[model samples]
Target chain A: MAVTLSQDGRFHRQLIFINGLLPMVLMGFDAWRGKLGVNPAEFVTRATGVMTLVFLVLTLLVTPLRKLLGWNWLLKQRRLLGLFAFFYCCGHLLTYLAFDRDWQLGTVFEDVVKRRFIAVGMFSFALMVPLAVTSTNAMIKKLGGARWAQLHRLTYYITIGGVLHYYMIVKSDATYPLWFAAVVVVLLGYRVVVSLRKARERVAVGVER
Target chain B: MNPISKIPSSEITPEETFLNRRFFMKTAIWAGSAVATGGMYRAFSPRSDVKSTGSEIATVVDSTFQSSLGADEKVNSFGEIAGYNNYYEFSTDKSAVAAKAKDFVTDPWSVEVGGLVGKPRVFGLEDLLKMESEERVYRFRCVEGWSMVIPWVGFPLAKLLSLVEPRSEATHVAFETYYDLKQMPDAGSAGIDLPYVEGLRMDEAMHPLTLLATGLYGKTLPNQNGAPIRLVVPWKYGFKSIKSVVKITLTNREPPTTWSLANPGEYGFYSNVNPKVDHPRWSQAKERRIGEAGSRETLMFNGYEAQVAHLYAGMNFEEDF
Candidate 1:
């Protein structure tokens, strides 16, 4: 049997929060040690971008994995993972602004307008801001369950946008980006199938009555 | 006997410079595969701390390499230059290239200079090294918005091209890098197409500043840095400086280049470093000078417009880029 992390355990959630920050800590350590290679700016930007994608993909996996494994506790951990994704995306955008564009709003705006990938990435990040803001329990309560759930469905579009951003920016090897795209597609497919099955069962029950 | 130019022997980077990235290769070999990062670093912490916060590339700089800091152009430390490379033949991951290329066989190599040439010949590694070696300190800019100052030791590409004696119709020169399926396992997946090719107009090939570099920092190139032979076009983006070249062909038609063939929009045939023409993906207006903080304004023609501008005197920078 494999060692398992329980979905709702507070200890595991805390562990994950620390674990999420670990990469940045290591990056800072490497930067300090002069071990981040010759191009530290590129390193930070790339590292944060990669982390954003990793967390975003992992966030997408939560619902699917929870359904398959029957681990309802995974829902309790979803907010933390989703927030980390947002955090890393912020780092990614800021690193580009600071190092690549010299904190120039005009330059970064030009990039967003002229470059398709940057535009997609910024749009995804923009979508994430509302998701992060509404993630609070109070906001969820105020919006009511059904409306909040409906709005949160935008996660699918945001994830798709993130994958598109990655696919467009890669120089040649689309292998990794393609892999991410495939996984996101499957995750989205699962939801569509589940909803269609539920609708068919509801119709069958009505006909029998 | 040909007279040679060299960086002063007094400025040779100490042996400690060799100890950094090679640590991974050694550990990977011992383990017969990749190991965890912490173990690798523990096994290879070669540099001692100076004033000891364990932070700062400047402090880690070898005294020999540090002396050049006073000069207007500080030549990057040998380790820093070699450790960060973009040899797409091995992999697209720049820093990972060193470990992947550690065991590459460069000794028994030959470059075939043939197409549209009068005297076709394949020059062995030894024969190529026999040419005069000159040390030129150049600012190397990449399309991805990063740059480095390197002291490259090699003879001009003109010296080798002249030997081949191109026919009157040979208007362009195409170059290719050495690609072995066994040695370069990552070539198949390295984003761009393999057997990397680059072209220069025949006049560009013969220009005095265009170099055929074999080494840097007064030493033979570490395998990661295109050992044995590579083209060093200082004015163009660094990718134009093809590495570990194994083939050179002179042609009447403009030759197809690797990056341009992969994606025509981002890269172009004449990838001269023009700040006015930005890469569609990133701004070329400014670049992060490697090993330094903050971005600096990128120079037109990488600050070599005075030297090589006449070649493109009539061409438009926007379209050519």
Candidate 2:
């Protein structure tokens, strides 16, 4: 698939569309079939959260995959993937507001203040708004590459907020959040290690000079 | 991969076709004979297994007595009552009591009555049930946090304690539940103190709001529900109504309770379902109407404030809370 997708925009688009929407469709079908037993509101909330994390990870992988494997096509799909992450994050917030809070804005505000989980989730959602807004090619050009990259760095903080939100809201099981945290750690760990190595190389070069 | 005709004669066998035909005939005959025999049995035999009454199999036996509730009663029936639970030891989950409490053994359940009473005696559940009049009706409110109107049928707690004839040393009455961790499984596992003990002032115990319940919705109490007997304090949070009760100690001084001891700032022995007194963690002003049976506003003192509020009129709820 990677060999064929080297020059193929259509193939990458197909991959993005299927990866972004298939899980949602399957979950929706299961819900409509009454297989989820209870209200399925929590299920939707959980699924959206997980997919948000998944797309965030995929978006982060773009730079590394391009650098290592010389697949520039991965860079073209980053914006789409990041937008999809925000889309699911919006769905996550919507499910909580609609089913959990009944869309009572007053109560939603109360929850944002009163519950720590809501605060964390709202923060993650807030971070996504800017990322989604700047995802367009025109905005990217307007912001310029350096400033845009700096702004998008907020996604790391968004990932942390998302994980904490999930962890705090879960009353019993920590396994899912624990797994997500571990994955986030590994991904973020890669970036930190690369940065540190680059810093050491720059220092060593300076000393040699 | 080759066609079947390419096989050797030795491997095929001359009698193979004949044996196969015979086997098919035998299978057909046996199946036909079995069906014919089953039909004959159905035709001649009495329909003992058939539910001609058009009722479901009773997983629980029906109670001989009715709730015979007071004038202000609001609920009835086993289906409605049994679904509602107030077991806090198993966590706040509504199904927790029913699911986790099966591990509790109420077989040799007995209550020790002492202190300030003229007749201090230990009474088994069987003996206690014999003394009380049985009636089933909805009683609601729990501390693990939920509300349900249940069809409960047992004599008033006041009526039974009167048999003991207090000598008036009982300024405060304390109730103790079975404390055996071996028998009551969730006692230590819940991360909350187990064998929960709750107390009421002597007047509160003798009040009409207190009940020593044995059965509900016209049947023996299910094993998960303290089985043989439990207390029902309709005005208090469900935790105040101790389950699998085995002892009653009337004291000259106020007795310590599980929640008060566990979190002094939160739960008090006088843990009445008052809308005004909010729990430290959440509001007691409102409660989710479980089973979605009726979305009625949760009442003050679970709507029994008129009957129970006066007991704590001079006292501070926030202090003890």
Candidate 3:
């Protein structure tokens, strides 16, 4: 299918942005209304963490979705999804630091060292910083598309790390994290299949020539 | 006016006049008001020690039993105690439990006390209530690294065990929580073995501090806080205090607990609140007290060392944990 810039494409882009901002606004409202449930700190922290993983998974889905369903407009939403993932991750970290730790840097540092899940979660968040910074078109052009794509590949590791962190933190019932893992596997598998098919096509063309 | 005058004035009096006709009726109303006022006065009176608030769980405070609180201890608000819980049989999310557990029917509940006991018996909710119960303020420590000071209203486990008459071979007391897939949606889905089971050594079961709580903060337990009855082993991690218990078996061998069965390495059978011992996933040295901003240093045996330390005197703390 041929990709085209149409009115529908512009509308979809706006929808994606609205979808990303909706949760942030709802979370703020929930927090304000004291509706964050029993443990507000933990509720916010887990909510943001789950949101981050959700957006990360959604961001990973864009390429496969476009390829499989021929929804070319999905490519435009990928950056929006990635940025939303980063935004929620930052919220997750802030909830931990401000509400959970009460800005006690020493305790937070000790936790990062002592707790394996926290350590992994922090590391994953740190890796996201550069990707988020270079997500802009200007920075992408500055770094060159080849190098930018290579740097952005860190998302795979970050997603894996986020899932692992989630899996480790739960006391029991790994259902949600397991589902996330399955999704990640499927997305990555799609990418592998597509690349293999493209390689086969290139070889076939070369042989025909 | 002429028609009204034709009627007898005494008979045509207002309804208020009829209400005041009999002295007995007047006295009855006065007595009823006095009783209502007296009941309210007693409920709110500072001198009235037993303060039973209206709640769904139906708790009755025993006035004879006595309990005192430590200087530093503070009772967590009933809202906090009831609102925040980890009744995984209902749900894993702490907040979801309160609402989800509303579907649970705690009335008409009975617990079967059997196995290795000479006189095994099935005790109904009322039968359990008949036993002497007291209000005790205790520090509750969860294995998830959170702590709360809860005012529990119940009797010692030893009193109930003694009535059952455990056999000479009985070395441990095992507990099982209620399980009904129709009622507890998460019971089938939480990935834990159904009918959550917990146990304590015979000595621990007979300990004076081990209470079977039915109420908190002078109110009947909220469904989320384990309505009808539950265990309250203050020195042990919160999971050790099984909730909505349906069965208790006295056995020679150790009983498998829910968490220990789920992950043996992470959760041990004892599950005593020891700062020196850490859960495989997280540290137990410090704990965030619910309703507090920052964490506090966890105490050995949750500050009941003097009472429970001798129980585990020879055992290795790290291994047993």
For residues B1-321, write the lDDT of model 3, one tens digit per residue.
668688886677575554455435545645665565445423321110112233533445555533344675567777677777889878876766776787689999999999999899999988987776778878999988888889888889998998889999999999999888889878777978878899999999999999999887766777888888999999999999999989999999999988889898889999999898877677788888877766788988898888889999899987888
Q: lDDT tens string, model 1, A1-209?
A: 21223432664476557667767776778778777766777767877886787788777788888889887777888889889999999999898778766777787776778988989988999999989999999999999999988887888888899989989988777877898899888989998999999999999999999
Better of 2 and 3 by DockQ: 3
Candidate 1 lDDT, tens digit per residue, B1-321? 334336666675555554443444444443442233334343322222211111111111122212122245566676677777788767677777777787898889999999998899999987877776767778899888888899877788888988988899999999999887889978877877778999999999999889888877666777888887899998999999999999999999999999999889789999999888878887798887777777778888888887889999889878888
lDDT, candidate 2, B24-58, per-residue tens: 76566556655554454233221111111112212
Evaluate model 2: give its TM-score: 0.64
Cα error, candidate 2, residue B320 (Å): 4.8
Worst 10 residues of 3 chain B by lDDT: B43-52
Candidate order by decreasing DockQ = 1, 3, 2
Candidate 3 structure quality by residue, lDDT tens digits, A1-209: 22223324654566566656666666677667655544566767787898899899998988887777887778877888899999999999998888656687789888888789999999999999999999999998999999999998899999999999999998777888999999999988888898899999999999999
lDDT for position A177 in model 2: 80
- What does DockQ come to for candidate 3? 0.13
| CA shift of B11, model 3, Å | 89
